[model samples]
Target: MTILLVEDEDRLAAALIELFHAEKYLADHALRRAGKKTPVLMLTARDEIRDKIEGLDQGADDYMTKPFVPEELLARVRALSRRQGEVLLDELRFGDLCLSLATNELNAKGQSVRLAYKEAELLKLLIANKGVILSKETILRKLWGDESDAVENNVEAYVSFLRKKLGFLQSSVRIQAIRRQGYLLLEEEAL
Candidate 1:
């Protein structure tokens, strides 16, 4: 998979780009001028909570703090690639809700709405494992990678976004938070 490595440190960027190349993964040091379908792995020395949050908020697929292990970095990249490949189906369905991976749209009843990258990824996860409770940690790892500084609240925020989109489409499917358990996608009548 192609990785956009946004690192300002010259030495670190060169090392990472070399490592990714050695592992047979394409990597670039600069950010693309336009949005890309390829996953991004942001490498930065900024480790403050707000910095990490801002990186994620601005659409970095995953974030890695400086002083990281090369092994862990490779693993995170593989995880992102795996998740990218897992959704081979063009569309996922639950009740009346339809999530289109190709178009990045969520449709329900007679309405359809485009989804942001992360939103579509989160919804795809829930729908792929419908009726299963995915813990906040699991969601965080699947969507943001383990190396990311994202917390449970990040998952909650995305869940809230998907919930609003579902509501906007008048969907019968609901993303139900299971308190101590996590979240499960269920039909409204099942709740």
Candidate 2:
């Protein structure tokens, strides 16, 4: 799961403040890395308009000043989290296949089928990490989230579901179960 880096100005030491200043200069790099889906809520004591503008421009999903009400701070965080789950409509492509992260649709060979949310996420993960074996534990943590009750069987079931969908779409790409290891996404020709 993604985490929020809650940097409070009052808690920072002099050197740390300087480091944060450097981070402002590097905001461009940080923006690209965080992308649109990652929720960034910046907490700072600096209430200047420019500082707020800079933080927002730097890709913070939301910004709040110091001395914020404890309840309101929590509300904003929850709001941001809910917003993150909203449809961004981003697409991840690999080989002949395309998976829509927002709508959970998988497409290939001019054919498409809707997938469950978990299935789409799993496909995206495999596509992004093609050729790398993803252990069951990693899958559980990523797809089911940290400290999830999901087990290896849950991963296997979703892999099975995705493989069937790939076949249905007539996609050249496929997911292979690596026994005693994990899973791999590959074209049939790569076998």
Candidate 3:
């Protein structure tokens, strides 16, 4: 996750950046202005509510003031991250294969292949977190909606199915096991 921290206070910004990093968030500082398309969390000591509102108007996901608790900031960032995950939709591509979330279609080399609901969800999560190791619990919660009755092996089954579909697509996107850790999406070249 990419987070933009817009704080003019040098010491506080550095401390918060460290805190965010400790929480496993990739935080970037915005000294002058926001960058292209990155999610932002603006911080300001400006008492006027307009300053906060203006930051949000400028595309910040959330805004905070000074004397704020670290826990509160972390919570807000987590909420924004969850919101982004929930609304994830776009034309996702990996290698030569492309999947259109809007159209619910998978295409490769100008040909289409059918994918089941679970298979598509699994593929989307893997593609979204590509190059990052996703734990088993994380994958299960994402695909199975945090239901306890959902067996852990369900992820394995869907992954297997996705592998077959990728084969049909003639693509090399594969779910690779990391022994005790979980899995990583490996491209044909990476594999």
Candidate 4:
């Protein structure tokens, strides 16, 4: 027998990784608590109301008992997937850069850089909306949630971080800041 531990910093990957891989009755409380909010579906043999209640309170977005029908399982997953407006792909690309959704690593020109979780999310947002202006309000709402205390400075800092990484990679892609507007992703030649 072998054991594995999944500790991805990305919330979605971290929450779901163990569920698909591990089937034991054991629940990794620490794993569930690893990152920020994620859509988690807890699967276990325990069918008790108390168990289900505890699971839900412990951060599970959904719960399933043992011997679940495969179709129902798929449907539940689909529902959770829709909860997050953005469907995470294996990778996202713009110009010469590739952002790995699973590992939060950005690659360009044969070189790679690991980004902090927030940095990755910001970069993903920018890539998904390449050439479109994304206001600070929009970025804050989407990435940090409306209720978060993150201010414009937070957004500015992350943007600066991404810019430095892009420079280090020597990628043609660059993030352009619109005065009193927002930020846009554009290749250097597009200037």
lDDT (tens digit, per residue) of candidate 2 on 1-191: 13244464322322232332222211111232544565676778899999999998887879888766756855765576577674322576788988765577888999999998678767766865689998988777656645457788999899999889999999999888789999988988777
- How would you order the candidates by TM-score, starting with the best? 4, 3, 2, 1
Candidate 2 residue-wise lDDT at 46: 91
- Which candidate number has the best lDDT? 1
Instruction: Return whichever of 2 and 3 wins on lDDT.
Output: 3
Model 3 superposed RMSD (Cα): 10.9
Which residue ranges in model 3 land beyond 4 Å of their true spot? 1-37, 40-60, 63-90
Taking every candidate in turn, the Cα RMSD to the unseen true structure, in Å, is 13.6, 10.8, 10.9, 11.6
Model 3 agreement with the true structure over 1-191: per-residue lDDT tens digits: 65777877756766786687456455556643645665678878775888878878878778888779989999898888887774433566788779876564788876888787677767766776789898878777555544346777888788788877777777766778899888898887986
Estimate the TM-score of every prediction: 0.55, 0.55, 0.56, 0.57
> Who wins the TM-score comparison?
4
The per-model lDDT (C-alpha) reads 0.79, 0.68, 0.73, 0.70
Q: Arrange candidates by lDDT, highest first: which order?
A: 1, 3, 4, 2
- Structure candidate 2, residue pairs in collision: none
Clashing pairs in 4: none
Give the 10-residue window scoring lowest on summed lDDT in candidate 3.
25-34
- Number of clashing residue pairs in every model? 0, 0, 0, 0
